[model samples]
Target: MTSMKRVLKLCLGSARGAMVQGGALTVLVLLAGVGLLALSGWFITAAAAAGLAGAGLAFEVFRPSAGVRALALGRTGARYGERLLTHDATLKALVAVRLRLLRGLMSQPLRRLERARAGAALNRLIADVDALDGVTLRLFLPAVAGALTLLVSVIGLAVLVSGTVALWIGAVYGIGALGIGLRFGPQALPVARRAERALQAVRARTNDAFAARADLTVYNALDRQIAHAGHAATELAKARAHRDGIERAAQFWVTATVQLAVAGALGLGFMAVTNGALSAPLAMTGVLAALALSEALMPLARGISEFGRIADSARRVMGDIPETVPELHPRHDAKPMVVPPLDLRSVAIRPLIDTLSLTVEAGEMALLAGPSGVGKTTVLNVIAGLLPPDRGKVCIGGTPLTDHAEEDLRGRLGFVPQRTTVMDGTLMDSLRLGNATLTEAEAWHLLDIVQMAGFAKSRDGLQTRLGSRGNALSGGERRRVALARAIAGRPPVLLMDEPTEGLDEATATAVLKGIRAYLPKSAILIASHRACDRVLATRVITLR
Candidate 1:
């Protein structure tokens, strides 16, 4: 019903097969351990009783000893196998989760993305996804294994001893231990979730303090910021302590129930032995069984406490994710065509542009000039289909933009904006964003067109690794690099938004010349406020 439930259910379905395998191994491990302990108790007790009665020589010890040894080995092997299987399955599930999250984000509407609070949403995407990684490993597998352990233990006791004894053991373990664990589990959900959030808050504060240390020192608030971060950490610690305290208490209650079950079995076994309904060796076996089962059941409390945290993680990770949209698959069958002319019909975007229509044909350059905040960039975005028009439509090559999938259409479009953001990677990596398979020679040629050939050649060339945000390059160089990337694919529609905003007149002129020379036949639309940009345009459109 809820986002958390939906996400958890989806993940469970995906990982169910692996979960079953791991759970089966876990159940084997627990059963073997309990069986070994019970057999050892019975054999030792029987041997002592027989020796005192002068029948030690006739008592069989070899078979029971071999059985104990076999069970011990089996338990050890199953425990190891369980760890390996569960961890591998969990890792595979996490990979699936990340892929699904990426697809979800890609398919989300741009408008919705814009509306989300950037920092909080981004934090949830990273942290919450990581938190959900433990769901399959810790909660689901353990709970299932615990259930299997209870079922097998109860059934065995019924056959070996009495139905009354089996019911007693089951009621104590199932109704007492497991019931208490489950009852207290939901209470920890809110507290544990709050603690997790508080921890995130502390981390965020610490990062902020480190990132802005210099600014804080300059403004004489460095100590204050540090103190604030310390306060956040303290709050996080308190929340964690409270959640852990609740978990500890639940564990105590479950442990007490287990002890009670063991005591009950021992007392009942004594009475049955006295009445000749049960043997002394068999009585010892039942007591040992209860003891071993306690070991298996106590962890149920921990698993129950973890349920809240996992549920919270699922909710956060999947809650904000928008509904899936139609995926844009590559159309390999579609033949490549010439770049189409860009057209806008009855385009009205609020107070910025009203009833505006324009077309930029091949080999033509259109300049859009307006004062600041006039939505020049918005117009470029609309035409690029990054944003849809409030009214009217945009067409390229006589096809409405809506008719083509975003991924399929974007391959044929080249866009360069005012601020160039280059990733921290090699020069080739940056250029490859436009065309992944572009050769080194073609990359060099594009760089030359943008006047970066000499600079790149003298340095590491295409292999040069740039600093964060491409800060290693000058403002002009970064812009040129972005321009080269945009033109690398030689797309039909080229949209430039304030290309020469932060450049000198000479640099801006060279940049415009590079564009015209590189993409001579592409339908180019440049939104700029500079008069020099208008001069290079074959036609200029002005907005008041």
Candidate 2:
């Protein structure tokens, strides 16, 4: 609950002023709506009674009718303004929350980040964020409006009608509204939360089925995926149906409260009229006011029932976020430096590569040849500052990686992970990602160094559009493009994992030479299985 409050505060703080104005307007809107209903009821009842009593000309209709019109217009305008302010502000707050949530997720260590970023967890993160809309827009503002409307309506009744009318109507209406909330909220909350989860499950399952369609089809297991998705959908339908039933029941209770309170007001008003203590018209006003006030408080009941869903979303989002976010990425104020030696000292990430120290200086290519699962990629990840080594320090230019921010420290190095990822964009955009200022001519030069100039020309030159993950290009082309992108910045240190994996022996040897020729002073580290990679290296470090 404390964490949920914190998350809500963060969202509300994003647009505090607008949210405040929206809330105030919410109260005004509901009050105006009640005033409109009550006034209209009084005008109709009083005019009809005066005509029956042969005194139609004695009753003034203009002022009351004018007041009704004014209240009606005011309510409409206020309602519009309230919607605009609250929704706009909430949208801005949602954007802020989304960025903060991603920043929080990104702060996790690489291993944890990978785990948390699996299809289902990431989908849940997004769903939870979307659900936060219910927090301020549904629960908070409406609750405030409902409570204020009830209080103001009670005071108005006392002044306009009679103290007795005010007392009984207020008691009945307040207790009934609160009772409806208390009755439905607790039972509906967990049910609503379960419904929300079930809905997300449907979405996640559907996405997985489509994503793994090929594998599922190959194994003749597509039906299983469909079954899982269908089961989630069924659960979602049941939960929502239950919530709908609860909401409908609440409406029944609200209507019943309105009638009971109205009946009491009618009883009190008739007695007052019989004794000549109150006019018949104002008596109708009191009864109608009770009806309007009861209806006005209905939003509170719905908001209360929705609290479960909102709290669950806030809790999940807040819980997933780490309080202490490490300053892994460099701040803009951080100073950049030239790349230094890739240094490791007795660095270890248990179960493999234990108690090892190594250094690759500037202008050297040190090949790490090792059997699979010997932590070659792990070493690259450590050097890339993605993974924190369990045992020892990894330093750059005599500065510890932890002390240095990523953009400040690793900004001086180029790292290509084993799995290639290219954003959907043109070839020029891909090349310019590493060095924003890279020119068309410079891009072609790097392409030539990696022997990809022909590949670029065969397509659209620099304008060739790459598909998702650069799937438009072949495996070898993607690798070369990744290599070209990394060296585009010409960092003094370069790390590549199985970089030459798909290329043939001759192309692989040339690509390696081209990278060295392109960055003459760069310190390069290659983790690979190919013999050609070891032959061209300045040194080879083998792992058992």
Point out where model 2 deviates above 4 Å: 49-55, 300-306, 324-338, 449-463
Q: Write the per-residue lDDT of candidate 2 for residues 1-544, one digit (tens) a residue.
A: 6765776687788999999999899889988977988899889988999899999999998999999999999999999999999998888888877777777877667887666536646654576788788788777777677778888888998998898998888888778877888798888778978887898789888989998999999999999999999999999999988877788888888888889889999999999999999998789888888877764667655666566777777877887677654545556654446467878888988877777788889888999988899889999998888888889998776667776656656456799899888889988899899899999999999888888899889989999999977879889889899999999988888999999989999999999999999888888999999999999999999887
Residue 245 lDDT (model 1): 80
Error of 2 at 211 (Å): 3.6
Q: How high is the CA lDDT of each candidate model? A: 0.81, 0.84
Clashing pairs in 1: none
Count of backbone collisions in candidate 2: 0
TM-score versus the correct structure, for each prediction: 0.91, 0.90
lDDT per residue (tens digit) for residues 186-245 in model 1: 787887778787777777777788889999999999898888888878887887787778
Which candidate comes out best when scored by lDDT? 2
